[model samples]
Target chain A: MKIKTDKIKKISKSSFTIYGMVIMAYVIMQILVSTGSLSSLMEGLLVPLCIYVILAVSLNLTVGILGELSLGHAGFMCVGAFTGAFFSVATVDLITIPLLRFGIAIILGALAAAVFGIILGIPVLRLRGDYLAIVTLAFGEIIKNFVNVIYIGTDKNGFHFSMKDAVALKLEEGGKVIINGAQGITGTPNDSTFTIGIILIIIILFVILNLVNSRAGRAIMAIRDNRIAAESIGINITKYKLMAFTISASMAGVAGVLYAHNLSTLTALPKNFGYNMSIMILVFVVLGGIGNVGGSIIAAVLLTLLPELLRGLNDYRMLIYAIVLIVMMIFNSSPKAIELREKYSLKRLFTKKTKGEDA
Target chain B: MALLDVKNLGISFGGLRAVDSFHIEVEKGQLYGLIGPNGAGKTTVFNMLTGVYQPGDGKITLDGNDITGKRTIDINRAGIARTFQNIRLFKELTVMDNVKVGLHEHYKYSTIAGILRLPSYYKKEKEMNEKALELLKVFDLDKEKDFLASNLPYGKQRKLEIARALATNPKLLLLDEPAAGMNPNETKELMDTIRFVRDEFDMTILLIEHDMKLVAGICEKLTVLNFGQVLAEGNTAEVLKNPQVITAYLGE
Candidate 1:
């Protein structure tokens, strides 16, 4: 019984550490902005940092927890961005308030992405590791390109859709083209603030960490460790797998909504919502150490910030990024590095302090 | 009526007759053993019983309910739980969490309840934690409850597997080679544990074992199979004394 409490306490403490880290960073960034120390370029990146953090954490759920590599997360984000942007654009006049409208848009975006996740997971999850990864990669690219051909317009006839150019919709006067195919949706309200992004990160952390410690989480992890044993123990393999996948995709969708609301224009480009974006999120998960949520959070922040910080070194920007990735890989995973890290970890210091109190 | 009854149970891997017309009956609280030489298809029978493999022929009834060829999860829910010969513990999960996973169906809470952490989540989780601890205690593993299953020594891993199996609250427990890798001391302790589990849980057990002493000591009844056919089925001592069984074990 005492051991159980210690375990629970340990879980909560680690979670608090993560929360503390985020809040501390927020305060420091705010201080920098107020003192005019941070550049205008760095300030622009505040919201994007939140989006990448979210993407990395959600992808960790699929790759680390569910033990399935999903490279099409960007596709779900693409779906969310377009759908949320469309909702906001279409209903701009109907809903005058930004908060209520963006809230509903986030929900709409998340639901759309979850639907796609279910559709993809139902078939693709049947395949194991490499095949699933390849299929998801293809799906990510397909979603990006698929959005490029779509055209939607709002008129008296109530939303015209066309696979061709925006002109094919043949809109009447005063009708608005909300989605201009590859040009994408523009005039989306910039509802995202750094504060809101931080709050969302807290919520995601709560949902994910809570889920991981619960009975459902244990069942999911069991399936990951040994599928046959989990089945024999009566865990519904498909249900848990689909649950984790859909939840992850939904979180990615929320991140997408956040991203769309932060931008004046939302586009499903190869660089933004394509396979490259998917791989970037995956690198955050992998380099952060799979299943280590806090590590991924830090990885997302550092990796996102590094490119900007190294912007002064134009010729060697990506080179520095690559070197950092390799170094982080070694530092996070190598046995000797782990030993050194633990030997000097803040956790150890805290433990010693507590032990002294106990003494 | 038997706790578990199988008649003419068979499965074929394409053209190969893996287990041909197998038969066994385990009464309530009986310690039944299935023994055979390597390649005698012992594990195949276990697979069929646990719904890992659909039987090519015959019926499987547990507590008089037909559970033939159900999915593995369904069969477990229907009161049959099993452990693997190779010790398929959830290696990454803590010992307590591993057992808690087996108690999954018995504990009632939705994914939403878990995520939002409603009052019921605390209530159920506390109860599960206590119950899982009680199970680990039964295996003398309560101390290592927080350790990952992979970090456990070999013998404890085997015991943890059984503890996980029993956590399902199954009426019958199937152990595939529970003593496969145990030393003599560990094997003796395991024998005591199997007997204690049978008595304490009122469990009907069917185990596959290569350890002759373990089989002869704990098993009240024995079924010997050779080349997918049941060579003999009777009292443990009588089966061990049979010349054909000896021949099957040692060969001419």
Candidate 2:
């Protein structure tokens, strides 16, 4: 469906033009995939790339849009990932076709994440921004730990099957639950194709794009910019904050499920959904400029790829990466980067003007 | 019946009583002003009335309904919308979006509509845009609808705040210093705009202003608050001349 032009036009003209460029980039990606020259590592990176893009953009919904720091995003991700994996692993043989199993698993995973998101969102949402962030972060840890303690050995019939028996039963036979615990669930059907991941990313991007442009989304942003003002003007700060938090979590859950199944593992390691993951997502939002959805997606892709590109640094890899992060943080806080960006953009604008005159 | 009836409302912070035994009533469609010198508890009165603070002892009734201790959103939903004393516009959002935020109370589409991109959502959304544009146009701000609220000039920002509150479709609008930082010319324009909004919205307004001239010019009735108590309450002319009000303003 065509986006309402009025809202689209309301964004800066440069941003509106950039939207076209993004679409073209997506099209070129599709062409590259069909041509099949993209390397295996690049192809492998695509799913995580899409997943992180969604996580970063969605997390920004709460952190950036509602002006609340939500560190508990990974917790919601854990919930959704496990829930989806639980379903797909439990019902793998129930659906004969691999394609159908993949489709259902992803959808179920997203829905599972959304459900848990609402559950987690309601309680801590009443807190102020800093408190909300901390509470959410704790929650992610809780979810991660909770999964480890959960008993996943019993089948739907309540029969506790041994790991060997469960494996022999075949995924199609409605056998035992697959998430084995800290050891990790193996033999997870890898249905997360680049096509599916990209499609999901596009859907998330469009949804967030529409939402931030919509009236409700603006209300959330309003609450973010000046909560007291938003409240005074009859906008309920808590309600909008909760909406953003839950929505962000739900999308993160979607990403988490993609990640779990794509990797064909279901280990509920606390480290997997730990504080570092949350910070990584936050860095994506902050580096991109908090409220800019397109920028968030771009940052997510770049950050996800950065470490991989830095792999050649060998022993100095993490040290150099740490230096880069410190530099980014230093530049970020003081508006120097913003000033430079503006100056650069001005030059581009003037060049475009000169080009127009020449034409 | 009074549109808003606040009786004996008070709030205490530790041993200090911020608002004590304050009472006021506004008849439907009347423009009432609450004014006092600095630290006169005018804002505290507004705060208690709007459910920002639960009164230690008091009752607030709106249109014969008890709204005492209700949450701010509940109060808003029950037809009381207010602006803050500190100008709190959503700084980063555009001017049109700011007004649209006010219209959020009227947005009926569910999250399902949002996720699915339903036609009903689009229809409702389009209607909201038209209404937001109309509201902005009323205040002569439609041209700058895309500009961030913080980017607007001080007077325009004040106007935007009022526009946003108006979007909530409140029966009783509380404006906490609508003319706080305005120059004489801007304040005059604000006075006219306030009057226009009151008449156009068919709303009862209870505004807190320190400017006596504005209180006298725009408010049909005035309540003079001193030390969390109503020092005087009557029609504007009478209250402005009251000895207690003069002392509260002049500080004997």
Candidate 3:
């Protein structure tokens, strides 16, 4: 029966075209880079560019799909990065022990990030839009600050701030050793490459895409559009919002891990995980068009490379950014774009229909 | 037995009783219309029935199942569907997508399956799409399947809301002022559509409407409220002629 069903499906065709297209895109990207036509700046931006695309798209699941604005998205990313980085460093010496060490670390990092996402999502999700955003923003700041105060090792006054020494101190403090205060965890193993980062980003992107198209996702969108109506229709608004938040944060965590391993250092500083980074990531979504995954990726990659392209005009770069954003917002928000898009699509649709009938 | 039974359902906001000792019992397959002047607590009764507010005192039952004080979603899951007076749609989504949302309960594929694009997810998704399209077609909305809901005109938007509610396969559909802003022609068309939906879906309906002619035309039974209490309840024609309902509407 299964064989017969499979055969029948193959005969009619399916969305195999989408998968084929995805493969073609990857091939095209690789070819562009390898042929040197993509430019060094664009190439250098690709890895972080891909990661940000995943982050922005995933955040959209919370902000757009779930219809709840989140301002502390980077906090989840931080959790993933630190966890992934810690695992990689701890298992660097065990590289000769086959895939067990590296593989385990990646899985552990992703899981740790997911767990933290759940923990953080539960409390703040009760609040409405602006309140939720503010709470999440505060939570991110708190997490960064908390990491800063972690005392990893003690120097020489009987105990010091050190990862090496924390192993022993943990035994006495009942496994409560601090990593170190504000110094950031140094000597992190640099194991993340473009391949792994891109792969994980793809995985996260696929997850987010699926979620937004799911029953749960539709419920979230309904709440965003009309909360009262959604409630009247029997959608568990709170549950779905929290689910979106947690899933988004988990994806951010995966990106964080990739970021930490790529950067080869963890700085428990406000500057590293600041509000600026959060806004920069959000700009990708807004510029790309909210609830649009493809647009988000395009925007992330383009925006990531924009600064590099304007590196020569460093003094006036920010001013240019502001102007571009303002212009885009003015054009995007007005009914003109919507009207134009509708007309264009309608025209195209009729033309296609007429052509098909004529043939 | 009453399909929806509400007893002593009252809600107080600070000093005033917004809805006081409101009571209603709607039988199966009943086309019940609730009418009242502004602040007469018609909508408040609907709210309490659907779990928007926990009544100061009340009990509600559906099919002999006690569902008092359940969350809105929980009450909905128990086979009650409702539409707002102000048409509420997923504005950014397509009309077909909006209908698909109402068919959410049927999609059983997990998030993992959906993300991985597993065969089951694909199959379920295909089925869902078909169902959504079918729903749109039922309401003459198939032509506007891809149009963003907010772009739909007023009358069509109202039709879309009813279509969406019916997609839930509800046992009892509640429409809160479905014809508030509609023209006479639209209302006439709507009266026909409401009857068609009720007969086709074999569902009971509770509607809150202010238009006496429209209410008297379609609703088999009527419940009139005045100042948070049931002023009149009987067959539509009989109840409309009642002195209490007349006095309440005339501000006597």
RMSD of every candidate to native, in Å, equals: 3.2, 4.7, 5.3
List pairs with backbone clashes in candidate 1. Answer: none
Candidate 2's residue-wise lDDT over A1-359, tens digit each? 34464545434354444456456766787788789987778878887887888888888787777777777777777777776677677667778787787777767777777777677667766666477766777787877876665455544555453434335433444545565656556667787776677777777766776677666677788877877667766676777777777677778888888888887777866556887787778888887767667778778888778778766765574465467667877886767775565456434311111111111
* Among all candidates shown, the one with the greatest TM-score: 1
Q: How many angstroms is residue B176 displaced in model 3 relative to the true structure, after the best TM-score fit? A: 1.0
- Candidate 3's TM-score reads 0.87
DockQ of each: 0.53, 0.40, 0.46
Q: How much DockQ does model 2 earn?
A: 0.40
After superposition, the stretches of candidate 2 with alpha carbons farther than 4 Å from their true spots are: A1-5, A9-37, A149-151, A154-177, A314-322, A333-359
User: What interface Cα RMSD is found for model 2?
Assistant: 6.7
Which of the predicted structures, 1 or 2, would earn the higher DockQ when compared with the native? 1
Q: How would you encode candidate 1's per-residue C-alpha lDDT over A1-359 as one tens digit per residue?
A: 23345667767788788889889999999999899999899999999999999999999999989999888899989988888999999999999999999999999999999999999888877665676688788989999999899999999888999999999999999999999998999999999999888988999989999999898999999999999999999999989999999999999999999999999998889989987789889989987878889988988998888877777775675576578678877787898986666556545311211211111
Better of 1 and 2 by lDDT: 1
Compare the candidates by DockQ and give the number of the best one: 1
Better of 2 and 3 by DockQ: 3
Docking class of 1: medium
Q: Give, for candidate 3 chain A, the lowest lDDT window spanning 10 residues.
A: A350-359
Model 3's DockQ?
0.46
Ranking by TM-score: 1, 2, 3
Instruction: Tell how far residue B18 is off in model 1, in angstroms.
Output: 1.0
- lDDT tens digits, residue span B1-252, model 2: 888998888889899987888888899989999988788788888888788777899999999989998888888888888888778888777787788888887977876676566887778778888899999999999988867676688888888888888898888989999888889999999999999988887889999998878888999998888887778899999988888778767768
For model 2, name the residue pairs that clash: A72-A136, A72-A137, A75-A140, A93-A171, A93-A172
